[model samples]
Target: MFAGAAPLAAQFPSDSSEPLAHARELLRETPLVDGHNDLPWRVRELAAGDFDSLDIAVHQDSLHTDIPRLREGLVGAQFFVSYVPADLIGNGAARFALMQMDLIRRMVERYPETFVFVTTADGIESAHEAGKIAALTGLEGGHAIEGSLDVLRTFYDLGARYMTLTHWASHAWADAATDEPRHNGLSPFGELVVREMNRLGMLVDLSHVSDSTMMDAMRISEAPVIYSHSSARALDNHPRNVPDPILRRLSENDGIVMVNYSPTFISQEVRDWAVTRDSLVDSLRQAFTIVDVTAPDSMVVDTAGLRQAVAGWTETNPAPRAHLEQVADHIDHLAQVAGIDHVGFGSDYDGIDAIPQGLEDVSTFPAIVAELLRRGYSDEDVRKLLGQNFLRVLRGAEAVAERLQQEMDPIVATIPP
Candidate 1:
């Protein structure tokens, strides 16, 4: 399709009229890469509804995914994640993996030209080249292999480019970020998994692993890695958020920390309030020793307005402009802490319920750029945060992948848990 092939000129508002035009023009022309998206499962639900036809007539704001929204969002390239429950590990992982892959394949078959099933880096470029949004695959948990290295290889062959070692759940071979006992970093077999994944050319994602696990896995892996969707703990002290020291090391190793845009991660106040609220409520329960008494208050969230919603919720939320502004700040901060070359955008859109108000979905990317510009981010730095930095790390991960595959047959990689 030609550039003019897009109905963007006729179907939507123009750059001149839109308030966010400056950033929009830059983001529209640049490649906006989001590290993780749960659209495969969403596509599964939408396919039942015929996503090509969004008939969520009863509730249009169901989920933050669909073709019409994608078009409206104007995202250039994306990774549709195949996330399965980690409990499905051991023997059933491959079944879940096949089901998700089948869903992606069906999506392609249902909308051939609108989506491109890309395998190679060139294929990704070409898909976007053809005016189609490039849809690549990412497996959210390593448990998708069911303890079989052969199954892991099959997933790589089927076009999975990245795999998170663990999910929020523990795996037989690895520990997880939540509730599980530690596994002394990667198990011996888990280390083999990392070596094999390096061989397979798949990028190892670390968005949901424990800190101890993260350090240990980093030591064994030969290639650069990515925390596909994590924030700066320095800003918000959540375990999910990577700290400065880790960020510094990731920078030194040529890895990346794609900034996640979930409201909880983006706003410290929100996290604190949530934590405080829970703690306070828990205290009340123990005080009364009764079933507890915090129901109506917990349910009463003032979504009546974004301002009201954020007033009590804005922990580190700079103005939305500052949100974008700090996004640049984070880019610069991570670069300062990690290195100028390592920060990237891994906005976790759709997977979360809320985001920075003005910047709700992928389409609002231009607003971020506009904010960056207002804060004096040159076009050069703008390009790097938008996608270039992530691409560089991806290329490096791919390089390491090829080297490992030649050295070992099964690609075993450890992930977060």
Candidate 2:
């Protein structure tokens, strides 16, 4: 455990009137399934995919997730993301994704007592009943499939329950929210990707996809879609967030928008600060004739000079802190817009660099639950937000897949030339 971190029992007091206590009791009964986390990526980065070197059995200060912290958070099920960067589109993206998936499976195998590898809704509940965290896999970028439906099916067979259509950059078929539009939304092959996923019971995750792509998938997918780690754009105005129109559409589609805790996505102030920082960095790069301004740290040749310049900028204009309340506010907005049954937590724990104040790490989940309780959310409503809603979506996808499999063959089409 990190220094000064309270013990699991101590984190929740015994006072009957305390919401934290109530929240703890509720989570004990209901599985708190987080839609996304990136512990596998962290393991791959820090230890070169060696779980023994970077042990999660005990507290590791460098990471946001650990076995002890997950237990304290009462996280019954977690989707460990196999995140391949957009830069790796055709350059062995599938291999990297497979490696990350292997890492998650190995983690589960390494700690059998703490985690149970689960690919179905029933498996999640069974693992939770047995007092184990259900470790599930998710593929973050569709580019990892290399424009092939067969590869997508293979990923599902390998235990990827959900696959985010795009990452930071748009690829051949899908348009990423952060990148310029190519196919305008999803190409013909992209629509087939959604259809194939529906037929295979894999949840279509729209977190980093563009608005058009999100709408197209929502229209094409027979199963309910999910923004696995997105906040309400009506709150923060970030492209990565779900807009009000999309939230309203969830009611008809019966999908869920798992709120993200990333400071830039949840806080308007933080979003604006990032915009200003990026603009300043770009201007500085132009002034210095730096070709690779993307490398923010020591990897670039302008390590010393650029660091000095950015350091001076930071000294004058420090970034504002994002509070826990701001995260709750986004959740509240999502519940209001998407309806109570359509919102849940997707705390992007290890995936994000900066976290909100109260939600510092995985163990801080109860704090958000307590905040919801304090804000007048009933126990039943809170239960839906915690995990029931996500499970319902998963079950919906499974049912859709079962029905579709009887009517359709595997999608064998390739990207059109």
Candidate 3:
């Protein structure tokens, strides 16, 4: 599957065409390294694992990402998320995770010319040199490992470089950002998981874990930790956003905080609206008997029926829109607090229901670059925010793994109920 030789954005004109041109020029030198994108899960939902149905080599309006859009965005590397819903943690979660991983591998296999499978920073640069997007795997949710160190190691073997310690729900061993604390941070097993991840050179992601968990991991992890997709909680006050205290710790730990683009995380006004909107949706779901909207099973969510049921509610209670500037504000705040070296982009594209106005799809990354440039961010600082920061974190993790293997034996600690 050969893609067009010309970049997609080359043909289109943006409002800030001058800055957009500058952004394109910068990307030519330093391509954007996105921390997370959920196109794999979207494919699972839309095509039921059938690549032929939603071939990314061609354009797909239903998705926020595609091969063409990625090229347009000048994405040097992407960590495609192999996400499993938290509800499935106990019931064959590990099996589902394998399936997700297989989908990502198949994606790379199917489009070799456009994407190159990569696990290391060097691999990313090599792929970029070949004019191909470096495809990396990131497992979202620790439940994917199902409480076994062997499973965690197996995922790393399968090309997953990072795993979010928890998702929306708390794991048996770890606490989640949104869920009530069960372990008061991380249980002994959770700490072991972090240590083992350190040993294996897998980046321990703190995106969905609780604040206490973030502190605990920072205190324990020999290697740097990453908030794969989070914003500044000081700005938005969401549980999913990182607090200032954690941002300060990231500088000492040598970690990076990839700011999330979710409207809920970016704007407090949007978050308030979302809360009301979600409450209304929940009420409608109960009234109309729709179960598991986010479930892997396509049959679990009656998409059309739910839409019709909630049509009036949606019309009356519209979702507030966030702007690209808000997204940059998050990056700015995170940089001011965490240092520019610790800030990067993680759009969470295809995973979130809506995006900010100027950043509607993958092709709009240049707009963000333009925004940062307008804010007096130097070309060098912008480059670090775009990709260099993440690359540094990746290299740091690899180095820690090498040193840990030399010094400490493999930890085999267990959780106690």
TM-scores of the models, in the order given = 0.79, 0.93, 0.90
lDDT of 1: 0.69
Quantify all predictions' global Cα lDDT against the true fold.
0.69, 0.90, 0.88
Candidate 1 segments whose C-alpha is farther than 4 A from its true place: 1-19, 43-60, 87-91, 280-329, 411-417
CA RMSD per model (angstroms) = 8.3, 6.0, 6.8
How many clashing residue pairs appear in each of the predictions shown?
Answer: 16, 1, 0
Error in Å for residue 315 of model 2: 2.0
Provide the lDDT at 370 for model 3.
83
Overall local distance difference test of candidate 2: 0.90
Instruction: Give lDDT tens digits, candidate 1, residues 227-264.
Output: 88888877767777788878878865788888887756
Q: Give the alpha carbon lDDT tens digit for every residue of 37-90 in model 2.
A: 999999999999997899999999989999999999999999999999888988
Give the candidate number with the greatest lDDT.
2
**Residue 132 in candidate 2, Cα distance off native in Å:** 0.4
Candidate 3's C-alpha runs over 4 A off are 1-16, 281-310, 413-417
